[model samples]
Target: MGRRSSNKQQGGGGSEVAPVRLHIDPERPAPRKLEPAITALRRGHVIVYPTDTGYAFGCAISSPRGIAMLRRLKNMGERDPKPLTMLVGSLADIGRYGHMGNAAFRIVRRLLPGPYTMVVRATSEVPRGMKNKRQEVGVRVPDHPVCALLGELLGEPLLTASVTHFEDEQFELQEPEEILRRHARELSVVVDVGPLWPDPSTVLRFLDDEMEVLREGKGPVPD
Candidate 1:
């Protein structure tokens, strides 16, 4: 049986939802083991899952409730212009949400499925709330099986944000047990694979077929 916790929502009108921790083999996650998480996402609930860079908060891209919860969890204000990153199953998925010009496409094609976040112009499919003031969204194709599988099962991009310590922004939460303890009320599921050391993905922004390094981290910059 899954562990349970109870808490009250801020402002005292509702109860907090307890998150279920699901342990699965990181390398070979069985579909049966992933069903619960998929169900939670489908129901507009947020989840915590491992990615190639680190652990991240994820929900169905179309879930407004889930997106609101994510923004609240991240302490993003209504006017905050930062865009949330979406985890996609493949390069083809990226094209559906982001507009990549020929020059940018050629470069991005070689660096994906790794630790990198690419910011591109958003397509009509992306929700307006998910895009930055510049009309752009961040997208990632992580080189992690769980991420790929989740995207495939969800049948849409998983809107994601890095799971970092609120007090210490530099500190990332890696262990599922620890993550559940901290965010049990805000999440519906915690996908456990084991502990992964903190290393954030490199962020690159593309504008009119030009690439610019916004923040360099795990992924190396190309010449």
Candidate 2:
């Protein structure tokens, strides 16, 4: 569980507070131990947690302040072409946020819960700030248990930003303590599951029943 300390850093303007660190088993995350992180998310606070690809910065989907902080952290502008990705619990949640055709759905059903990011038309449910100029959004269903449980407990998709080293984009922050050392000022909580190497998710775009590979990474390209 997270410490009882305050976790209210907002849009890079608030006083710096020590981020609460919660260590949970990556293979079998206990819900009881996750309550504090859940509470922080409900309050629209940003968190750092492990994902199938790597660790990512996360916040509730409906948080404007959280979104602002995320964009600032990523050095992204208001009209940046790159859309933010969301972590969801299941395909059903993906459908709720994105418009996936039958063909796209079939492909996603097969490859998801792995390391893949599907770009699709966003539904009205998605916040405008999270979409790209094409009105598309990136969505993921990570195979990691901690990510799965976080989505399940939050009851909605979490807006995510990849945690990359500012000095070297190629380097990944593998340890929770290192993540805290660098980002404690901006985050509310850090969900630790030991070290994990970076392996970016494969990004694919689906439009008009056609599929296009945007960026190939960890996930294998489908035939």
Candidate 3:
């Protein structure tokens, strides 16, 4: 594991504006070596890391600044009002932030630790901004191990959103090198697990007894 932090002050205000880059094995990222990334999240910094689908932006769920920065990076409008997704380490972690009934839980249990984003009713613990008017939230448990360890160490779900190449809506970016070049000033840390294949997690919405497919991406919708 390699940790590189940029501490150059921005403008005359003496605010440091450099992003840290960490290259770790996607299979099993050592917890001790990931302390720097944890520290960045603790300080409300945005991180770019690989997932089962592709590279995505992440930050502490409790950080308003981090959330606002992510929205800005993605060019989300001031009143865009779209709910962001939550990334957790395991199936058990989902209940902490969202409400999953028996049907929903059983359905989620079959597909998680793979490429899928399931929408469930949000609990009060989830930040309001990350929930829609109906208080439903999108959650994911990526197949990648680094993010699982990250969520475990951080002790909470992370705010997650996909990253694109230079405002290109047609593609999702997977190259860490390109992310470093394009988003260095905007991010606090970039986790490099090499180039992942580009794809987006399939999105599903579960409202009470009803289940609906919101977006058809990488994962197959459960029949």
**Candidate that scores best on TM-score:** 2
167 in model 3: Cα distance from truth in Å?
A: 10
Segments of candidate 2 deviating more than 4 angstroms = 1-16, 165-169
lDDT of 1 by residue, 80-162 (tens): 77788899888888889998888888888899889999999999999877888889999999999999899888899999998
lDDT of each: 0.83, 0.85, 0.79
Model 2 lDDT per residue over 146-211, tens place? 998998899888999888642355775488878776777788878888888978889999985799
Give the alpha carbon lDDT tens digit for every residue of 1-223 in model 3: 6555444623111146666678888897889878878987888888888788888888899988887887777777545655678898878778887887788889889998899998888889898777866777889999888888998899878998888532355674367878777777777778888887678788888877578998888899898
Backbone clashes for every candidate come to: 0, 0, 0
Candidate 3 deviant stretches above 4 angstroms: 1-14, 165-169
lDDT of 3: 0.79
Ranking by lDDT: 2, 1, 3
Candidate 2 at 2: error in angstroms? 3.8
Better of 1 and 2 by TM-score: 2
